[model samples]
Target: MSSDPFEIFLVATPGLEAPLAAEAAGLGFEPEIQPGGLTVHGHWPDIWRANLMLRGATRVLVRIGAFRAMHLAQLDKRARKFPWDQFLRPDVAVRVEATSRKSRVYHAGAITQRFERAISEELGAPIAADAPITIKIRIEDDLCTISLDTTGESLHKRGHKQAVAKAPMRETMAAMFLREMGFDGSQPVLDPMCGSGTFVIEAAEMAAGLVAGRARGFAFEQLAGFDVAALTPLRGAEPVTRPATQFFGSDRDAGAVRMSGENAMRAGVADWVRFETRSVADLQRPEGPAGIVIINPPYGARVGNKGPLYGLHAAMGQVLRDRFAGWRVGIVTSEGGLAKATGLPFQPAGPIVAHGGLKVRLWQTGPLGG
Candidate 1:
């Protein structure tokens, strides 16, 4: 609300800071790298652009302000005096979460309660943990910073997939992987290890100029004083399209293949992609010159077998070299040694994401040089 540029934070995978920052800059806001995200100072328009274009971010948060409090009394007084009506509505339920370091307010629950009371007393809103809106509080070195999560559900839920496999790729990760692979989706795309067809589906959607946020609702809609009508027009824009021979995917598990088919239907992209069931070892190249190929094979930790996964990687590399020359490949894996076992010339990619507590990296190759 203040004319001062509001601080916007974009939470992203650790190694993806550069790409996310570049994306933010492309949207006309210079972004700086923070611990777990990218930080940009901007207004509401900038916030909207971030939601519209960011491919690597998990969530977008706007920082209202920060205050230093030596103790609970100081925290209470400052929090109570700070304006609350600018964002909250009396009818909306809201909750607070706090983290601390070197401050007297060590207990997280106590801090949350006092902060909740301040908001309730000042703005007359009840604290509801199940409320749609969540206010995040961070207390470090006696400095308290408050931010509002503009993205209610994680951005990964693109609202298209009605079903998923055991370990489907999240929409956010799929988008980032596409960018890392230089995918504009003008040419052919394939995902042989496509569990739920997320990569292929996302590529098809992007190629068709479908805006990720267009089909979904955001937490900002519930915030006070939002222009719902303006947002509606943005989401209502028509989708772009091209000929339908571009995207394809396959999986070994029959159930996964069926689930992918259902998901593609729900995403309205069944017409855009071809799905089938085939083991990675038996995967074949598309009947075209060259394009992008992405694979999110089962990591050992998740699937509980490292020996066979190594064989799958070797077989995948062999198939690509022998049959898919001139094609570019992007492989997502959480294990460093296993990625090396593929025996492909790969460059270190954007980030190492925390998927199920294991570090994952995107390993990519240029067009196979025969």
Candidate 2:
């Protein structure tokens, strides 16, 4: 509501900050890369746009203000005087969360309770366990920073893909990986192990010029002075230009293939994407120009065995090498040995990203030799 610029933080998965920052920059924002995210200074509409368009961010948080509070009494006093009316509505239920590091206010629970009391008693807002609006408080070295989560649900939800395969990749991470592999939606993307069709669907959406958050709502809608009429133009559909090449996905399991197709359909990309049941050994390059081939193959952590995974990776490498000439390859796996077993001339492995409680890296290669 205020005309002043708010510090907008785009939360990224650990180890993937650079690409997310690049994404923000490409979208015409000057983003400063932080430890786990990127920060940009912008007005309220910028916060809304980030939540709606950024494919790599997990959530968008707007920094309201900060204060130095040495004790709980100071924290409580300052929180009571803080102008919560600018951002929050008294009619809306809110949730308060807190984290502390190297600060006197060590107990996060007590910090949460204090803020909850301040907002409820002073600002006349109700605190609820299942509130869609979240106020995040972080205390570090005696400095307390208040932020609001503008994104109600994680951006990866994307309001589609009701069906999922085992160990499915999040859509946010998939989009970042696609960007990391130099995909601009100009060429085809084929995922031989496309569980739930994340990569293919994301590529199709990007090619179709679809907004990532178009299908969902955000926490900012619940904020005070949120002009829905002013925000409606940002949500307008862009001209959809179908890509010249089709995005493709395949899996050995018939059920997985079926699920991927259904997910693609829900994503509104079924027309530009294709899903089929086929094994890696049976993979054949599509009859078109060379493109990117990315796969999140089964790793030791996912399948509980490293022995068989090596052969699987090797077979994948063999098929790609023998059939898909002039195509780049990207393989996401937690084990370096498994990536090496592929025998592809992989460039340096990408950042170690945290996925499903396991650390994984992207092993990529230049165009395969004929």
Candidate 3:
């Protein structure tokens, strides 16, 4: 909000902080990883770019200002005097959220109320519970940090995939998991159990060099200091390029396969992706070079009891081992027993990624040998 570039926080899925930081660094950002996210210091342009290109971040936050507030009275006094007019406009609505710790102003509701009143009365902005613009307040060790949520919705929404299957994998997690497998988008990707084709479409988009956030509008567009002229170029959608290699996905259920094709069409990667109604046991390698085969198999909760999943996983592993020569594999599942059932040469991946309230780990294999 100030002339000086504010610190940007890129929130990642809790277990995937490292890969997200690596992604930010790959995009030419100097990022420092914190507990739950990565921190980068850059101007507004970087904020726009981070939202547009970085596929792994769940939210992008800008640290507008910080101050010391010991008590509620002192907090109210300082909040009223803060120069909010420079950043907030009277017409735009705002929502304030606060957290307090190790300070006399321990009441989060009071802190939120004070800031809300300050912005409303002093800055003349209407306070709305569902406002697009959000002001976040964190009071730790008596130091209050005020920040803005530039990304209104979670980045995983991606404005595509209007059609989704049960417990679909988020696009953010798909992108990060692909990155974790060292996928630069050049190699072909196949998801045999592709629900809505999340992995395949994401791979197709990446290989075509598409911008991650191109399909959606962001909260920053509604901010007071937003410069339309400056951001216009960045908002331009790049031409969808033809990928040299292709991506593939398949599901046994006719409805899931149909949904995948529909979602792929919506994502503008339908031409580069192929979806088929094929079960995992019947999966075969497509007409492409050696590539990555990733699948998010159903656990006990979704499909049924764990007893049959072992044989299902074993069949998948055997099919891949026998047919898909020289290909690598990534299997995501909550149970290690299921992953081990694959009987592939899987080396342990780094962290247990949490998805849909279930902890899952990615088991990856190097290229297969003759």
- Give a tens-digit lDDT track for model 3, residues 13-104: 98899889988998899999998899999988899899888989999999988999878889998999998887677898999999988887
lDDT of 2 by residue, 1-370 (tens): 4678998989998888999998999889999999989989999878889998899999999999999999999999999999999989999999999999999988999899999999999889999999999999999999999999999989999988889888889999999999999999898999999988999999999888888988888999999989999788887455368778899999989998999898877778888888889888889999889999999998988888689888988888888999999999998889999989989999999999989899999889999999
lDDT of each: 0.81, 0.91, 0.89
TM per candidate comes to 0.93, 0.97, 0.97
lDDT for model 3, please.
0.89
Scored against the true structure, residue 115 in model 1 reaches a CA lDDT of 88
lDDT of predicted model 1: 0.81
lDDT of 2 at 123: 86
Considering lDDT, where higher is better, how would the candidates rank from best to worst? 2, 3, 1
- Per-candidate alpha-carbon RMSD to the true structure: 1.9, 1.2, 1.3
Candidate 3 Cα errors over 4 Å, as ranges: none
Where does candidate 1 clash, by residue pair? none
Candidate 1 TM-score, C-alpha based:
0.93
Better of 2 and 3 by lDDT: 2
**What C-alpha lDDT does candidate 2 achieve relative to the native structure?**
0.91
List the pairs of residues colliding in candidate 3.
Answer: none
